[model samples]
Target: MTVLGHASFFAGRPVVEVPASGPLPAVDGPVAWRIDYPDWDNRTDETPSPGFRDRFDRFVDQTGESVQALVVGAWGYAAFNPAPIDQLCAAAPRLPNLTALFLGDIVSEECEISWMRVGDVSRLLVAYPRLESLRVRGGENFRFSPVRHGRLSRLEVESGGLRPEFVRAVLDSELPALTDLELWLGDPTYGGDTTVDDLAPLLAGQRFPALRRLGLCNAQIADDLAEALAAAPVVRRLETLDLSLGTLTDRGALALAGGQPLTHLTMLDLSHHYVTDEVVATVQATLAGVAVNLSDPQTPYIEGDEVYRYTVVSE
Candidate 1:
């Protein structure tokens, strides 16, 4: 086990703890991995610390048993070229067990269009051919064309705003057999713009055939829109749901609570909305058969700046 912290080009850099192999305790298997470091917002021409790269290479080379899943983030904020990242992946011997690649804030921040669109979604997708799980944020003018892959199981897109065309592209292609979908839209500064309309349209039809988990966050959406989106017959197996924002309202709640039996849902979150005590009570009563999480009756929605952020699950 090894953890590496890196600074791109910012001051007041804090020291990061790198993991060492030993009795560090057991973690879930299946190519499970994660990396955190400086993001694209702080890029410079300076080369990364050699020690940092060396340690990473060692992890891929000497880590016990092939890593089955990888969750990478914070770092790798340089412009998207695919070559460098591909080289890094190639340096490690073939990881036969590698199945999933979890990326945080890289697709949107690092590969940002303003920086330079060296590559599109196609490039990165090909670079990490074994990726099964992908999570990204802060993308601007980034267009992705979904490619076909057989091992992918989950895809999470967390952004201030997501384009409809790109969203459609995601559903069109079969990558690693995506089963879980999570999307976060809405930019506070530009509250409700063209982007809001572009958000859910990507999921208009049977885009995700195997999707089972859906999470929507911080978007200019309404209950009706959410209800209509959730009524997809193909997504009948959805097990976990998180709809937090003003977009999810009473009508959307009623639509979901009344329609479709989400039999597998174990974790359901409905927080930071305009839900009243009566509405919450209605949901609680309707969803009594299943475990649902609604905001406390006394908890009122705060105005100006009260956004619900942060929800992480590990298994």
Candidate 2:
């Protein structure tokens, strides 16, 4: 049988790629697993074959208590299926070592980033009590029911547009160990209803005391977000801050440059923005030791009567 996927590593941990064929790896210490079906778009329908589940079950059987991270790639196209999560949950007793998960790793070839459907992720969190990191891509129809997990430390959601309800769900969650939080607030056209006001609690430092890294990215109103973050108490304690893949302009860059708290951060990410070269230079100079990312500067354009600034990812 042809091996569908291969195994690799990131930061010394093993990463397993689940392809359409081949036997699951029996090696231990698999930190991540990516599920991908290359023939998804060409298939007659989106429903995955029984072989998919069989492979997953085999993976569970082979890895049992060793796998720590799971990355779900394209699965036959019909939105994303929660069946894998259900399978993992049902076998949680044997997979107690699982901790990190990245859902919806599909690209434009399989499905547009904004078009990928996301179901409620509450059950997944509840099932994995030892989960330390959870990253999800795509936001259409995404929902997160209020839940608490003691070991969850990193939470990231990337989307063309993030809904307010989802943000509210994170805000309401009881994650005492959460230290890294990244939310991609995409363009308003793709269901992004959250405003800076909705993030007031996080900005005010009234939540997530253990948070050391924060990312408020892929925003349309990045300038406003920067302004809010500049004055927020949360910035005072963050070790890393990310405001990338957004329409950030000089106004936002200035807010960060002028801010005192940002100087203390070890790293600052401001890539894929609309800031001028001069502003980038100024911000970089201000935060001397901080590793800054100021790549992919965007030029403002005019389409019809209104000015247009695009986010890095949008349908």
Model 1 — which ten-residue stretch has the worst lDDT? 1-10
Per-residue lDDT tens digits of candidate 2, residues 1-315? 011233354323666675556666465643577665434444444344455567677767766786777776665563543324555568778879878877766667567777665677767889888888887777556778889889898998888888899898889888889999999888899888789998988999998999999999989979999988888998999999899999999999999888765768888999989988888889888888899999888888998898899887767
Relative to the true structure, candidate 1 reaches a TM of 0.64
Q: How accurate is candidate 1 locally (lDDT)?
A: 0.50
Tell me the whole-model lDDT of each prediction, alpha carbons only: 0.50, 0.77
Clash totals, every prediction: 16, 1
> Model 1, range 1-315, lDDT digits (tens) per residue?
001222221111222223544323344432245444433444355444244355556566654345655554444453432213443455434555555544432433334422322124444456566666554443434456867766667666555445566666666676536667776644433222324345443444345556667666655564644576556554455677777643555677777777766655776677655666667787778777768777532233466788542222100
Q: Give the TM-score of candidate 2.
A: 0.89
TM-score against truth, every candidate: 0.64, 0.89
Clashes of 1: 16
Write down the RMSD of all candidates, one decimal each.
Answer: 8.1, 4.2
